[model samples]
Target: MTQSTANFKVGNEKLIKVLDGASSHLRGLLEKQGRPDGALRIAVIGGGCSGLQYKMDLVDGPRDRDILVPSNAVNVVIDPKSALFVSGSELDYSDDLQQGGFKVTNPNAVVTCSCGESFSA
Candidate 1:
């Protein structure tokens, strides 16, 4: 297995928190896709209304520069570069009437779009 150079902690908590709703949603998706062993990979990439966007996916395993963070019962993986942008973020799920999906609460973000889908640090 490839090793990671990224640090996985921020103050008293892990870099990110995969809340129960998000973890359950991820587990269900993985089960349906027959990839129960898969992990949720969260990365920040260029391009969005606010300049930076969050890209998430269910990955089979960790890459060479991935920081593995265990949250709830889910494994949250972050690339080294993305890790810096989301160091003190929380991965959560929302089931509201209008907007419902996985949301990233990132403390490192200096400015975020109105929809909360993108941000700039």
Candidate 2:
């Protein structure tokens, strides 16, 4: 690959941002699961009203070709295709009872469902 191409890919490696709240929450979750070395896996899935949704899980680490992003001392793993949809997105955490959980603020989403968990990019 050309130098510019390689530089571009490296630039996009940190496309997703994890907020302070998300980092803290995720770190707690990892500790609770007894996985200090674990990482959070974020993936886009089908079935939401907007045609896409996020499915997250805690895994041991990144698999082959998985993009690993370290932000706020937390490790996040995302696949290549999902990276496209979630580029420039920020991950945050909420502790409210009504809307409590990890949330994504994605700039690429053109439309979103009422549940706030699904979107069309």
Clashing residue pairs in all predictions, respectively, total: 0, 0
User: Taking the tens digit of each residue's C-alpha lDDT, what string does model 1 give over 6-119?
Assistant: 434322235888888998998898889898988888889998999999998888767775788877887888887888899888888888877788899999899999778899
Q: How many backbone clashes does candidate 1 have?
A: 0
Candidate 2 residue-wise lDDT, 1-121, digit = tens: 6532111122233578899999999999999999988888899998799999999999988776678888778888888889889989999999989878999889999999877799998
Give the runs in model 1 whose Cα sits over 4 Å from its true position: 1-13
Query: What alpha-carbon RMSD in Å does predicted model 2 have with respect to the real structure?
Result: 6.4
Q: What is the lDDT for 1 in model 1? A: 100
lDDT at 64, model 1: 71
Residue 69, model 1: lDDT of 83
Winning model by TM-score: 2
